[model samples]
Target: MYKYLFFLTASAVPGAALAQDSTEDALAEILAAQDATGPAEQPADNGGEQITIADQLVPSITVTANGLGTDIRNTGQAVTVIDREELVSIQGADPTRALQRVPGVSFSRNGPAGAFTGVNLRGAGSEQVLVLIDGVPVADPSSPAGGFDFGSLLTGTVSKIDVLRGSNSTIWGSDAIGGVIDISTRADTGMQGSLELGSRGTAFASALAGVSEDDFYVGLTGSWYETDGFSSAASGTEEDGFSQIAVGVTAFYDIADSLELSGHLNMSEGLLDIDGFPAPNFTLADTAETQKTLRYWGDIGLTYYGADLTLRARYSRADTDRSNRADTGTLSFESKGQMERADLRGEYRLVGGLSAAFGYDYQRNQYETSFDSFAQANIQGAYVQLGWVLGKLAVHAGGRIDDHDFFGSETSFGGDVSYGLKDDWRLRASFGEGFKAPSLFQLFSDYGNRDLQPELSTSFDLGIEKGQRGTGTHFALSGFRRDSEDLIDFVFCTGLLPSPCSPGQFGTYDNTERARAQGIEAEAGIDVVGTLRISGVYSFVDAEDRMTGLELARRPRHFGTLFADWEAGFGLSLGADLRIVGDSFNDAGNFTQIDGYELLDLRAAMPFGDNLEVFGRVENVFDIEYETVSGYGTAGRGVFAGVRAQM
Candidate 1:
C-alpha cells in the first residue's frame, strides 16, 4: 500500500530532475583531509564542545553556480556564507546589516527599522540580484522593478545565508545579473527560544521547536518584533513605529530507502508608520501614515537518490500584499503580487570525476494594483551544466534558454575554472552572461512599454586565495568587471512631436541606458590567539553610466569593514565591528553628494549554564549621524539585550 502511494505521488508531478543533493559529501571530504594532517579538535568557549579544524573554516556544502552541490573552494565565483552562529554574534535585526560586511556589496536604507532597504552587489541594482528563501524566489512582482525588499526580512528564523556574487543567469535564469542570495531556515531537531528588549520601546520574542527520528522530521518557528522608532524623514519630529509577526514550518518524510518527501511554509505580516514628502516643496513631512504588508511562501518537493544519480521535483509559490492608509482613515494605495514556479532537476555522476546536471523551470507572475486591473506573465526555461574534476583542476560550464510571453526568447552561458597551485593556494576565474526580462509593471502598467527589450549583461572575475586549514588563516583577492547594455529606465513623455507624448504625466519604461562596473575585492581573516580572531574586507568599485560617463547613484566607490572578537574565560565573549563607506552621489547626474561615514558597534555575551545565555550589543556606538539615502533618518546610538534558552 505504501509503495503504491509513493508511486502515485511521484507520477502525479511532472517528471524532471531537480538537483537537490546535499553538500554533506563534499564537506566530509574536506573534513577528512583536514583530519589527516591537523591536530585534535579543541573545546568551544560556551559548552566545551569539540571544534575541529574544518569547523574553524566554517566548512559547509554549497550549490555551485552551475546548480551542482560542491565545496565552496571548488567554485570560482565569489561567495560568502553566514551561519546561524555568526548571525547571533552580529546582533543585527536583519541579514542586510551582516551582508554589508561582505566585499563588493553595498546597502541603502530609506529610514530606520522596517523601512525600505536595498542591496547592491558589485554595483548592480537590487533588481539584478535574486533573493531566495528556502530555494524559492521571493521578489514582489508588484514592486516597480520587481526587487526583493530587505526591510521585510528578520533573522529570527533564518539558519544560513549564502551570498553569491556575479552573474549566474546560466542556471538561475533571469534577474541574476548581480548575483543570488539564498536564505535557508533551521531544520535541526530540538527546541530553542529567545527574548530581547532594547531601547525605544522595542521587544522581540522567538521560539523554535522540532523533532527528528531516522525516517521523518518536523520543525516549526515563530517570532514577533515591535519597535517605537524615530521618524523616517531626517528632519521630522514625529515618531514612526513598526511591528511584525512571522511563522514557519518544515517537514520531511522518507517514503523509502531511496525516496524522500519534504514541504515548507512561511509567512510574515508587518505594519509600519511611514512619512512622505509633501508636494510643492518636496521636503520631509512630519505627518504620519500607515502601511501594512503580508508575505507568504511555500514549497513541496520529492527527491530520489540512486547510487550514482539524483532526481528532484518541486513546486513553490510566493505571494505579497501591501496597503497604505492615510491619517484620515482613507485607503491611499494598495497592491498585490504573486509568483508560482515548478522545477524538475537531476544530476548524475558519469565517468571518473565527471558530473552532469539538467533542469526545467516554469514560472508565472501576476500583479494587481488599486489603479490597474490585473497583469500576468509566464516564462519557461531549460538548462544543462557539466563539471569535470581532476587532480588539481576543476572546470564547470552551463547554458540556459528561456522563453518569455512578451520578450520572446533569451539565452545565456557561463563557465568557471579553478586550479590548485599548492597545498593551500588556489587560482580561479569565471565569466558569465545575464538577462532580465521587463517586469509586468514595466510592460503593462500606466508607465509600461511593451516594446522594451530585455536588459543584457556580461561579467567576468578572477581571484586567488590562500587558506591555512589548521592555523585559521585565510586571504583572498578578486577583481571583477560587468558590462550592461540596453538597460531599462523610465523617461518622461513631454507631449512633443514625433514621440509618444503624454505631457505632464508619469513616464514610460524604456531600454535606454548602458552601464559598466569594475572593482577589486580583498578579504582576510586570522586567529590571533587561542580565543581571539580578526577579519577585514575591502572593496573598490568604479561603477558608471557609459553614455554620460557619470558614476552610478548610491554606490560607494570605497567600502570596507573590520571586525575583532575575543573569547575570555568563564564563557564570556567580546566583539567589535567597524564599517567605512566612501562618499557617493545621490542622483544619476551626480548633482547631490552624500558624505562618507564610519560606524562602530560593540557586543558581549556570557553563558550562565549549559542551556542559558545572555547577550547584549551597542549599535552606532558614537551616534554618528549618517544616511545611506538622502532625506532619510538613521538609527542613533541604541542598546539591545537578549536572553536565550536551548533544550
Candidate 2:
C-alpha cells in the first residue's frame, strides 16, 4: 500500500505543476484582457460603485464596503482604502495606531480594552466614528448609557479597512456623525495563507485560505500576537504588557446563476495591563487589569434580478477584571464587569438605479463593580437609506431614529449629491445632522444626575474627484463645520473632588453647549510606475468651542501623512511613511499642552520562497519624542523583524 501511495503521489506531481502554470497563465490573460478593455467598457464602472465610495470590484483597489465597482476617484466622496500590506507594516497591538496615517483620523487609548478608547474624525467626537464589520454594526454593550469602548476590538482579525470621511450619514446613521470605518475580512480566493514570528517579544501568525469556484468560495483566517513591551518602565516592561488572539471565516455561495449569498464570523480576546497608582507617565506598580472580549457577526443575504440584497446580525461581549494592591498596604480588591450587544439589519437595491436599505437594532448593557454598583441600560433604533442615479447625477439620502429609555428619542439625517463635470471629473457636496447620546458615565458617574440629553450637531462637506488616462490621481479637498448642542461639559466642580485640584470635567449631557470643528482634508493617490502607490493626506482643523473661546483638548490644528509603497520583483515590497501632528491643547484647563511632533516609519519584505518571506520594520525612525495623551510619553524607537511562512 505504501509503495502504491508513493507512486500515485509522484504521478500526480506533474498534473499539479501543470495546474499551477495554467492558473498563472489564466490570471495573466485576465489582467491583460482588463487592460485591453479599459474601465469605460465595464458596466459597473459606468454605474454606481465608481461613484459611491471606492472601486469595490477592481482587483487593483477592490473593496466590498463601498458596494460598487468604481474606484474611489469615481465615488466623488472623500474616502481612503488601507489594504492588508499597510496593516501589517505599522506593527501595533491595536489597529488604532495605524489609523494615525489617515488624514482626519485620531484616537485616544485608556488602558487598552478595559476603559474607553476614543476615535474621532473631522472634529466629531470618538462616538461619532461609526464602526462596522463587514457592513454590520457592533453595538456597545458596556456603556452605562451609550458609549463605545474602542479598544475592545482586536485588529488582527481584519483583512482590510475602508475609511469614508465627513458626513457618511446618508449611507450610514447613528455613530456616523464623524464618518464610517468599515472593516472586512479577506475572502478566500484560491488557497493562500501566512505565518510569522518576530522580536520585541513578539509572536505573530495569520492565515487566509479557501477554495473559489465559478459560483462559490470559502475562506478561513486566524491570528495571534504576544508582546512584552517596547518600554523600559515597569508597566511597559515584560509581564506587564498586551496580548491578542483573533479568528474568522467567510463563505460565499451562489444559490442561483446570478444570485450570491455570503456571511462571515469573527471573534477576539485582548489583554492589557493598566497600573492606576503610578503617576501619569509612570508604569503601574499596583492595580493591574485583564480584559477579554468576544464579538461575532453573521449575515445571510442574496443578489438577483439586477439588484443586491443582504441581511446582517452581530453579537459582542466584553469583560474586564482588575486586581489592585494599595501601595500604602491597605487592601487589594478585584473589580469585575461585562458588556454585550445584539443587532440585525438588511439592505436591498430595487428597479432602476434606486436602492433602499433598512434594519432594526437592539442593544443592551450590564456591568457590576466591587464598589457595590450594578447598572443596566437598553436602546433600540431603526434606519433606512435610499440612493438614486439619473444621467450624470447621483443622490443618496438616509435617516436613523433611536429610542433610548434613558435619553429619550433622537433622530439623524444625511444626504449627498454628485454630478459629472466633464472628462472623468465629478463634483460632490454633502450635508447631515449628526449626534452622540451621552455616555452612562457622563450621565451618572461618581455622583451625577440621570437627566442628560443627547448631543446633537449639524455637519457640511464638499469635495471633487477626477480620473484621467495617464497620471491618474484620486484627489479630494473637503471641509466640514459641525455645530454641537447640549454638549456635555466636564468641570472640576469644587464639591465633587477629593482635593482642591480641578476635577476632570466630562461632558454635560444637559449643558452640551456649542462647539465647532471645521477642517480641510485632501488626499491624493497617484499611480506611479508599475504598481507604485504614492499617497498623501493633509488636514487642518480648528476645533474650538465658539461659546468658551477655547480649543478642544487632544485635537490638532494640523496633521498629515505622506507614504509610498513599491512592489518589487519576486514578491518583494518596500514602504516608507511619515506622520505629523501639530501642537494641541492637552486639557480644558488650557495650562498643559501636548507639543506637536513628527515621526517616520519604514518597512521591507523579501520573499524567500513562494510561501515564505522575511520582513523588517522600524517605527519612529527619527526617535521623535511625542505623546498623543498629555503627561504620558510614548516609545522613542522600536524595531521589529520577522519571518513569515505559508502554503
Candidate 3:
C-alpha cells in the first residue's frame, strides 16, 4: 500500500520513487550514513486511540519537504504533517480548522462552512500557495487569482496531509511562491465509516471500503453533508443552508514484478444559500441568493522500478462549474474552468549517497463565463535536481525553466541543506525563487490587462530542531522572509478613454504592487506523564506593501494554538485545545480594524466494542463573536457527536 502511494505521488512531486520491499532498509542505511534521524514506522490507519502530542513528534517520511520521502527532520524546509488520527480527533468536515494549528499558517472565511475560505502561509497571500489532492493540482483557472478555495474540501476519506512552508517553485512549477499543501486520500485496504449530527441542523456521513489482492488494490469512498447555517450578514436574521455530496475511487494494479499502474477519481456537488445586499438598501443584509457548484478531478499513471532507477508518467485533469441564482430563480452568473496536465519524471541513484531527479511537464488552462466567451493559456516546464549526502550533512539543489504562451520564458532556482548535530539537534537553511503567471481572468476577461507580467518572489529561511517524533521532548523554530514584486491588483477606471483606462471598462487588472512578508514560527511538544501530553504552536508575521507600508488585509500579526490530551481509564480519552488570534486590519488601507478573539474546544471519545467508537465535541464553548472578513457572520457555540467503525 505504501509503495502504491509513492507511485501516485512521485510523478507530481518530481523526486519520489516507487520502492521495493528492501527499499526501506536501503533508505535507513542512507540516513544512517548522513547521521540524520531514522524513519519512524507509519501509524495505523484509523485507530480509536487519541493522537498524543508525541505522535506528532515522530519523524515520518515526508515527500513534500523534498522530492523524495526524506525524514521530516532531515529536510531543510518547515513542514507539518497531520495524519489520519489527528484528523479524526479534530472532528469536523472542514480541514482548515486543523490547519490553523500549524505554525506559519492562518485562514479567513466570509461566513460559515461552504463559504469562501482562503489560507495564508508565512504571511504570503492565498493566491501564492499551491494546493494538490491525490497528486492533482486543483486550483480554479477561472478565479481572479488562480487559487484554490478551501471551503469545499471535506475530510471524508483523507489519510494524510503534508504542508511545506517557504518558496518551492523549483519543484512545484508555479503558484508556489508561498508554499505547498498536499492532501492524500485513503489507498489502504479495509473498511471504515463515520456518521455525525451537529448544531444548526447539521448532519454528515461518510464511508470507505477497499479490497487488496496479491498484486492489486482498489478502494471506493463516498460522503454527504448538510447544514442550516446562519446568515452571512453580521446583523441579518435569515438562516442560510448548505448541502453537498462527494464520491471517489482509487485503484492500483501490478503488471510485472517491478511495474504498476494506478488511477484515482473524485467528484463532488454542492448547493449553498448565500446572503447578499438586496434591493434599495444595498447594504450588508440578508437576501435570497444561492450558488450551485460541480467539481471533479482525476489522474492516471504508470510506474516502473529498476536496479537503480525509478520512472513514472502521468496525466491529470480538474474541472469546476459554478452558477448563481437570484430570489426569483433567475441565473445571475455562471462560470466554468478546467486544467489539464501531463508529465514524466525519473529518479536515479548513482551511488551510496548521490542521486539525480528530473522531470518535464505541460499544462493547459481554459475558462468560460456567462459574460466572457472563453480564454485559454499554456505552459511547458522542465526541472532537474541533485541530492548529495556527506557525513552529518545533506543537501538538495534544483532549478527549473518554463515557457508560457504569453510570458515567453522564466527560470527559478532553489536549494536547501540540513546538518545533524550532537544530541538529536539539527540545523537547516533554504533559499528559493518563485513565480506565478497571470490568471486567465486577469489577462483576458472584461477587466483584463494584456501587458501584465508574472509575479516574482524570493524567499529564505533558517531553523533548528531538537528530537524526532516519539521522543519525550521535541521543538522547532524558524524565521523566514519573502519579497514579492509585479503583484497584480485591480485598478478602477477613471472613465476616460485612451487616457485613464480602456473604453467601456469599469476596472482593469495591472501589475501595480510590491510586497514583503517576514515571520517567525515555533512549535513544541512534550510528554508530561505516562498518560498526558501537551503541544503548542505560535507564529508572528509582519506582512505589508513595500510601497505604502500598510499591513495586508485580514492577516493577524500574532496567532497560536495550544493542545492537551490525556488518556483516561477504561478506554476513554479527553482533549482540549485553545486558539488565539490577535487584531488586524480588515482592509489593505488599514482603515477598519478586526478585533482579536479566542476559541476553546473540548472533545472526548471511548471505545464501544472492538471496532466501534463514539465521540463528541463542543466548539466555541464561550460563543466568542468575531469576523475574519468585515461584515461576515461567524459561527457561534456548537456541539457535535459522531460514531466511527473500522475493520
Candidate 4:
C-alpha cells in the first residue's frame, strides 16, 4: 500500500500530467518537453469510456525501484504506489492519515497535527527509512535520528507516492535499512484548487496553475492550513493550534529534440503549538510551547533521451530551520539542517532483453544547534543495476558502494526475481542488504559518540499474486524477515560505551542493540461488480529485541484495513474504510500496554458539471478512543467537507 500528503494544485510542465496511459509514454512525454519535433504516440483507446477512479487510485508504474519509470508488474520487490486519486479520496489535511492503509507500516504521533511523527516500515525504526521528495533526500540532519517528519507533509502538494518495503540500501544508499518513500508533487497543464473545513476549527486551501507551450512550461502552486487542535496531552485543558503555508514553482525548457532543462522550487513554513513537561510535576502535560519550522528544497537538472540510452544530471539542495519557544517567548531550542547533492545517472538498453542502469552521487550534510556547534559530513555513492526479461521471467540485480567521511566504505547488494504462471498468477522473491550511518546529531552533539559504527541489516521476502490491479480481482500474499545489528541507542554514562565518557554527561549514543522482525502481509481486492469494489489488507508482524526477547516499542502484532467503494448514480461516489489495530507496548521494556482499537470512516463525493466537485467525510464514525503512543491523545469523531475546481 502506498500513501502521501496534502492539498491540491495545477500543472507545472508540459509533460508533467498526472494522468498517463502508460509509464513509458508519461516519461517520454515529459522528457521530450516540446511538440516541435513530435509527441509520443498515445496508447489505443478502449471504446469511449473514461478511466474509473479505481484505475487511477492504484498506480502501475514505479520509479523508485530502478531509478526510472518501469511497470510495477515487472519488478519483484514489494512496492506500493498511491496516486493522486487515492490521496484526494482520503481527504485528510495531514498526509500521515492515509499511510495507515498500507500493510506492514505503522506510525505514531506525539500529539495532534504538526507534532513529531515517526513511521515504521516492516518493523524498522523510523530513522532507518530513507525519504525522497522530488528526487532529493530531505531528512533533517539536526534531528537525533535524522528521520523525516510525516506530520509536516500536507496533502494536495503531493500527487503520488511510491513505497518500497524491505531493505533497499543497494539502490537508495544509507538510511534504507527499512525501505524508501519517494514522493512526487502534482504536475499537470491546468488550473486547479480546493478549499476544506473540518472539525476542531480546521481549515485548508490550495491552488495550482501552469501553462505549457510548444517548447516551455511553467506553473505555480500554493496552500494554507490552520487548525485549533484538541489538547495534545491526555490530561490538559487548553487547545493547541497549528498552521502552515506552502508554495512551489516548476519550469522546463526544451534545449533540443532529445534534451531538456528543468528546474523546481518548494518551500513550507509551519507553526505548531506543542505540549511539554513543566516543573512541579514534570510529567506529560499541556504547556504554552510552540515550534516554528521552515523548509526549502529545489533542483535543477538536464536530461538527454536517446533511442536506446538516457542520461540525466542534476544538482539539488534541502534546508530546514527550526526553533522552539516557551511561554515567556524565550527561545528554548533552535536547529538548522542542510543537504546539497549532485548526481549523474543513465540507463542503457543492451542487446537482447538486458538493460543496465548506473549512477553516482555526492552529498554534504550540515547540522547546527544552539548548544552544539556546526558539524558536517560528506558522502559519495555509486550504484549499478542490471535487468533482464525473458518471456515469463524477469530478474533484477544491483549493488551499491558508499564512502562516508567517518564511516569508511560500505557495500550493499540486492536482487529480485519474478516469474509468471498460468491463470494470471505470479511468484516473486527478493533479498537485500542495507546500512545506516550515524547522524551528525548522534556523532557530534553534547551526548554524542564518534566511535559508533553504522547499523547493518539484511532482509528477504517472497510473495505470490493472482490478477493485476485496475482490471479486476487482485490478491497478494507475501512474507518477509529482517534482522538488524549495531543499532544505535542512547546509553547512560555507565562506562560501557565504546568511547570514553565525558564528565557530567547523562547519556551518550552507542551501537549496542540488535533486533529482528518477520511478518506476513496479505491484500486482496475485487471488482464485486462493474460499479462496486471491495478491498482488504492484513499484516502480522513479530518484532522483538534480540537481547531482551521483548517486543519492540509501538509495534503492533496485528493490523489491517477493510475498504469498500461504490460509484453511485449521478456522478456520485461513496466509500467506507475500517481500520483495525491490535495491542502494543509503549516502551522497549514492555512495561506499559496500549489497548487495541477499531475505527471506521465514511466518505462521499459528487461531481458538479465537468470542472467542479464537492466532497466530505465522517472520520472516526464510532468515535473510538485509542492511543498510538501511551499518554498521548488521539482525535475523536470529526466531520470535514471540501470543494474542488479544475480546468
lDDT of 3 by residue, 321-423 (tens): 8888998899998888888998877677777777787778899999998988898999989988887776667888999999999888989999999888888
Q: Candidate 2 versus the native: TM-score?
A: 0.76
Report lDDT (CA) for all predictions: 0.76, 0.55, 0.77, 0.77
- How would you encode candidate 2's per-residue C-alpha lDDT over 1-647 as one tens digit per residue? 00000000000000000000010111111111011122222232343221211122233332221233333433445566666666766554456666776778876554322234677788776666666555344444234333445554445545556677765443344456666776655553445544444444666555556665555556666666666543322234434455666666666565654344555554555555444546785544444443333333343333332325544344434344433445454435444344444555444557555656565666655554444366665667777767666566666677878887787888777766777776767787777776665555554556344666666778777877665311467666677677777776654545543332223544223454678899888777788898687878788988887777898888888888888888876677888888888888878656788788888888888887676677888878888867777534365567777665555
lDDT string, candidate 1, 84-120, tens digits? 7888888756667688768888988877788888889
Which of 1 and 3 is the better model by TM-score? 3
Which lDDT value does model 3 have at 72?
74
Q: Judging by lDDT, tell me the better candidate of 1 and 3.
A: 3
Residue 233, candidate 4: how far off, in angstroms? 0.5
List the RMSD of every prediction in angstroms.
6.9, 10.3, 6.2, 6.2
| Candidate 1 error regions (>4 Å) | 1-59, 468-471, 495-506
Please give, for residues 1-647, the per-residue lDDT of candidate 4 as tens digits.
11111112221110000000111212321211111111112123335343322332325556666565556767788887777888887787676667776778888887777777788899997888887776667787888788877776777767877788999888778898988877777756689999999999999998888776656668788888889988889788788888888888877776776676777777878888988899999998989988888878777777776666777777878788888899888999998888898888777777655778787989899999999999999999999988776666778899999999987999999999888788778899999999998999889999888877899999999999888643478899999999999999998877563544567778888888999999999989999987899988899999999989999999999998888889977889999999899999999999999999999999999999999999999999999989998988888999999999998
Least accurate 10 contiguous residues by lDDT in model 1 = 10-19
Candidate 1 residue-wise lDDT at 166: 91
lDDT of predicted model 3: 0.77
Give me the displacement of residue 505 in model 3, in angstroms.
3.0
